[model samples]
Target chain A: MVRVVLCNCPPEDANRLARQLVEERLAACVNVIPGVTSFYMWDDELCEDQEHTLLIKTTEERYPELSRRLAELHPYSVPEDIALDSARVAAAYHSWVHETLSDT
Target chain B: MVRVVLCNCPPEDANRLARQLVEERLAACVNVIPGVTSFYMWDDELCEDQEHTLLIKTTEERYPELSRRLAELHPYSVPEDIALDSARVAAAYHSWVHETLSDT
Candidate 1:
């Protein structure tokens, strides 16, 4: 199975973190999408932030490690590091993702 | 039972489709993310596209309608409308999403 992890990070740290994940083989591909405006209630106040979202493609077996490593490397005290399940995917693309990883 | 649908759309039509989904209550929230580069094999040749991705937040029960509606409104001959399972989500946020939709 494959998982697409969404990590909300500060704009400054986004590119570096994306590169790190791919370099470490934690993710087959990491797309650093910039220019996102996040609005939410925090500490009894509505706060808005300009953040970047990292779209990570990796296998289920490597998910735990990837999550942990992301938290460790991420700058946020409380990171929105959630892994959404890939209910469906193209077989060929899925295979290609696996082949790109180190231990596949 | 929330679902996150990823739709690959041309940059020009992304925002309109996102608003349509929200207006029709097919999705509670649609995040129109720009600056995506997609590469795939089409017709035995490598194809590259600069597109935007729509991250739609909706419930599992409404998924079929959402998918159908998206395809009908989409400009692509075959839109990438695979719904990724929301395996986990914050309780408060999930409830908030449901409340925003008309059918909820």
Candidate 2:
């Protein structure tokens, strides 16, 4: 029931997005990983860029809104927003995530 | 199916583990994210530590070996090895990942 969403953005936008997501209750916590080099294809051309990756943690129920808001706020026209379902989560950490998001 | 495995380790071991996993073919690529502050509970106590998070990209079929090798090489007695199943991936990137691991 937990989802960790992966998103890569420019380094300048990293902290702003992370703070907004957590503040808006769209995510319980957001971990920003800086200076990641991502290599992928865009328009049939290989592209590589330095980015800051955001690890957004939220529950299944909040994911839809989180995804929507992320798209609306993201700088890119089509940002990478991939959700990964956690196979196993530590009980305490899981509880904390739920509680933090629910304590609205 | 593609999976993104999350593992947190000390800063000193990040590049070594990332390179080892990729070189050993357990993972197609590993992104090292430095200076992650993780707040979790261990032994009924709250612990906050700075860690380097490794975003390991691999196939579901190759996960067992990756997990085993990660545990063996990690410095922590009980390391965090959480696998998240990628709900969706870009076609080109996904193909590249599969091909990279399969070429061995």
For each candidate in turn, the TM-score is 0.59, 0.60
* Per-residue lDDT over A42-101 for candidate 1, one digit per residue giving the tens place of the 0 to 100 score: 442334567788889988877778877887898866566557877688999989888887
Task: Put down candidate 1 lDDT per residue, B1-104, tens digits, no spaces.
Answer: 56777888999988778767776767766666778899999999999999987777777877889988988999988999877676655444566556655443
- Candidates 1 onward: DockQ, in order: 0.17, 0.21
Model 1 - which docking category?
incorrect
- List where candidate 1 sits over 4 angstroms from the true fold: A1-32, A37-51, A54-82, A85-104, B102-104
- For residues B1-104, could you state the per-residue lDDT of candidate 2 as single tens digits? 68888899988998788878877778876777877899999899999999888888889999999999999999999998998788755444567677778766
Candidate-wise lDDT, in order: 0.76, 0.81
